[model samples]
Target chain A: EKSSNIENYFRESRLEEFLKLTKVTNSYGIFTAHHLNDHIETFLMKITRGSGLQGMEGIKEFIELNGLKIYRPLIQIPKHILLKFCYKNNILPNYDYTNNSNAYSRNRIRNNIIPEFEKINPNFLESINRITKIISQINNKEKIRLFNEFEKLEPNYEENNISFSRIIFNDLPEFDKKLILKNNSEKLSSGTFMENKHLDYIIEKSYSKSNNFSLDLPGPIKLIATKKRITIEKLFEIDFQ
Target chain B: EKSSNIENYFRESRLEEFLKLTKVTNSYGIFTAHHLNDHIETFLMKITRGSGLQGMEGIKEFIELNGLKIYRPLIQIPKHILLKFCYKNNILPNYDYTNNSNAYSRNRIRNNIIPEFEKINPNFLESINRITKIISQINNKEKIRLFNEFEKLEPNYEENNISFSRIIFNDLPEFDKKLILKNNSEKLSSGTFMENKHLDYIIEKSYSKSNNFSLDLPGPIKLIATKKRITIEKLFEIDFQ
Candidate 1:
């Protein structure tokens, strides 16, 4: 795994540990204190990495994975507020030294980029929170609309494969088309989301004059565009062998 | 004028000068050397200022104002490429000394924020340009759709005032609702756009239990929401007096 993916790796490992602990303790769910500052830093990081609207929703408050509920109740509360609360309650919060090491992009954003934004607007975090709230609301509506359009296409799903009419797909709006491709690709790949470039490649090939074309997506997914239809299928190790 | 608006002031002054020069020289239009780097800087600035999707489109490549067309032919080209071409041609480009001043947010973003982004991705500018292109395409389609929705309401327009059914307006999607308010506010105010807070205030009040309410927008526009309809009117000096 790359250094950049270390954060995700740790997060997954921690969640797995939490799941095991939860089952042993018979707990209802897990709560992590990811605050507003962390949320804003993530938002900035996503923008720098060139994420689409779907990626700009910032951190979600609630998520459920493998029958375990994950909640971030402090997402709306700023870090300073949380720290003050801790101090008032005589609670000693652990300060991870790695956060100040600047070894990670998130640290760089927190130490460098956020201060610059604060110089522009003292309430930058709150402002970003408001904007992202609106964005998430819009994303929710768009998600429903996109699902409706995808369902209207009468897509056929067989095991790890999904297929839909090429003409109907082509006629959809560019945003919806890209989203539908993303949604289906994620579904077929068991939650592996394709990058914008991969989706763009599939869309471009699908619209090309050629009658048939095949491309490999990041999830080891196979996308075949024929004269009448487009199909995406996840490839397993057996198929590769 | 506030110090923050100095850039807009200079831009408008420059455009006026360009219009005068164009008429005198019998030129068709004006071309400005705003390259990809500048575009990315503006994008970062907008994000820091908590802009919505519409504001994330960055800079426009072309603008037609008062019968004089303004073009940014270098918008797609990177500043380094332009500098290299100028060096090869033995043409000296003037470097604005003020650009290095951290007093301006744009300068801070260009000097501080962007280098950090480069550390994350070597081709960050190109990535940003691609994302913004997709965003602009989506914005264009959304603009047309929003206009169609606005027209479906069959709004009444007279002089500097426009009115539509409150129930119909309330029924539109959140994104479309905000955008329609923006579009109409700009139209009534002769291109002055209201901030998100003002639009949110209007929307919130419109949905309140009160049967009748009135509020002032940034453009000095008056928004009056009644039981059956909502009206927005630009207030002139005479009306204010």
Candidate 2:
């Protein structure tokens, strides 16, 4: 009965939407405590969903949402380790009981999938640790480099505040094309962005066509491409809703 | 049998000899791939044994042999994630089936403990992920800050490398004090540093006692504290055997 109420709330309003409605953005950032197993489950989910590096980039310890920063300090730890830590510190947190249920996808992973996997290979955790470390280092450097390049090309609009032009971004490296689109789209007042595929559609169309084309981005940012230039504009006015 | 034979060969010669014979040095770093599960298992084993962080710290990925720059990239990852990753990537690594048997403390965790854990709390993985992330970030920043301060005080051998005078390090903040001992001790030509407590003992002696007192270190880093000055020298030429 209690679980039904929880399920009802989920059906009525998506978790993401609910968070957005209540989210009070401040200097510190939106924070979450996601541990290692959660990360693994998420990684698997994204992979199953066929998400690329951006989706699989793990949970962001710090993310910028409509100029509000989000942070997750616990992304690097695993579940069992955290519990041990709590025990060592003599801090016992409330434990949840539904994890063993096969109904939830993540719970299924915890019970059936991973245990079966551990049975097949004892060093399973070790291998994931290696891959994630490598990915983090490489991705972090790449993000920094791309962000730096982006800052150079994207004009800062002090007067309009959230507005930026995409004309300059067109001149950057092809690899960065996706980065610019994602950033610019996220920058919009809607607080959403054109996906990788959507951005790709725009980019692909830009080369073949000459007319001005507008993309109704998921976020506040809009994209208009013409033969002469590609422009990214913020449709929203203020930082907050 | 083949795997056991290979493991035994490595255990007897490669592992044992490496552990016993390798001189701890500053010139190179020793690294290990300790995963998140490994750390938790360690904490579990220690708790079951009625121990503390001495064993628990090894639960997380850390620079264990400091002079050797021993790194554990895989320490932050859980076993299930690694297995899923391996499955997705078709890595097909060898499996160690001993984890299924609860003969050892960690194996008990692998078999009985964690499963019961998921039963009570489905979000156990998520909670762990959050805690580990916090620890990793804190540890990472702490290392950087300690290294930066230490780097400032120590004589620059290269942009990254530096030499710390024993006397100067004695005056550092407690935060930087242990780090200096850890870092400088690790960097010596012979690998190893005295225990943290012993390093503290040496530091106390440097300030209180005459300037020219020699303390026995665990590794090749020599500590000669005298009233006139303190000296930390690489004593790899001395016999470790």
Candidate 3:
């Protein structure tokens, strides 16, 4: 039934199965062999999709979901190196059928786009790696700084609700304000982050002279802004009426 | 002879001829019709070439080149809209023969990569436009902040030379320090900016306990670091020894 959205189904179903397996086997984490080439391809895909810095973060070495840990131990290794090691060990690699076909966006990028990039700069992958490393480092530092500022704001959290002073939020730099709102939204909704446009709308409304207004987000999260405070809360089924 | 390196020659010759025309005509600026599609193409090309935020800034509406002002009034307009306007007026537009050929990187992006991107997101152009706009705005704000911080360091500039306190420079964030060094190098060299690798090398050395070291850059720009100071100076022909 979900075949029409095969990509989403594949991702969600894989995770669902993996979580069940982890519980059955009592494993703390699972490691995947995503390499440098995969990382670069993901970065290129994000750029084409008009991603901001957060989205362009490519792949991380570690991440946790619902108390389950995932690790990418070979992320820094190049695919060629892995292939060489496999060959030397007389190990045949399993290849995904779709990876060789251009029907997928990632395959197209790997086949068409990356070769042209290589023609422009033979060491383009290394250059991309270096640049993204620097960007990620800067992003990490900024994330720490922003999180610290958010903590200092003394936001109040109730059951299914998070609220802070609109006056203080309005005083923040626009970029910082947007990030704080995004982080809080993601927190209250577990993992769903608000889109930039939605955040912009809420921010614009927050700055308006109106004393009271409310907006609904995709997670049925409601944001209410008043004369002095802004509240983000998860709306219940009955609240929709 | 120049035809062997046609792209560079074309760019340099065009700029040189334009400057002469500006002087002869006594005009403050010249306007070129570079639209949104062109900007997006340039952005994609830069990404393929592994450009940083500055390179990915696409094109500015106005830029000054050796006292000649250049303007792109149609920068925000999409090419299709301009074409429609031209057609409605029964105007014949001049097309560049090379633009239709995939020999050029820009043309390849226009013909091949972008169509694939459209399939991924039909409104991909607008999405790219929006993201780049936000990135450029953030970049401009950060530039101002970095420049101000650079100014506060009170770097001393002599003819063909600029120097600042190493202690103060070392205290800056890695990203800011890299930008400051890049900006200063460009200033001293009258527009030759250092590559990220070179900047990284300089920055790594600056943090080292070694008190005195000197490095030579492409423009014969010399960077000398002492226990307390770092100097950037343009080296003349006789200084090569």
Query: Could you give the C-alpha RMSD of every candidate to the true structure, in order shown?
Result: 4.9, 12.6, 5.2
Candidate 3 chain B has its poorest 10 consecutive residues by lDDT at: B1-10
DockQ values, each candidate? 0.49, 0.03, 0.42
Candidate 3 per-residue lDDT over residues B22-88, each given as its tens digit:
8899888799888999888887776666677776678777877545689999988888999999999
Better of 2 and 3 by DockQ: 3
- Candidate 1 per-residue lDDT, tens place, B1-241, comes to 2332344344445567888999999999988788999898887777677777766778789867645798999999999999999999999997766444334888788888889888877788987887688678767877888878998876998886899989888888766788888878766643355786777887887777889999876544788888988998877632211
Report the poorest 10 consecutive residues by lDDT, candidate 1 chain B. Answer: B1-10
Clashing pairs in 1: none
Compute the interface RMSD for candidate 2.
Answer: 13.8
Q: Where does model 3 sit among the CAPRI classes?
A: acceptable
Best by lDDT: 1
Q: Cα miss at A117, model 1 (Å)?
A: 1.5
Q: Which portions of model 2 miss their true places by more than 4 Å?
A: A1-31, A67-69, A83-104, A151-173, A187-196, A219-221, A226-229, A233-241, B1-241
TM-score per candidate? 0.80, 0.41, 0.79
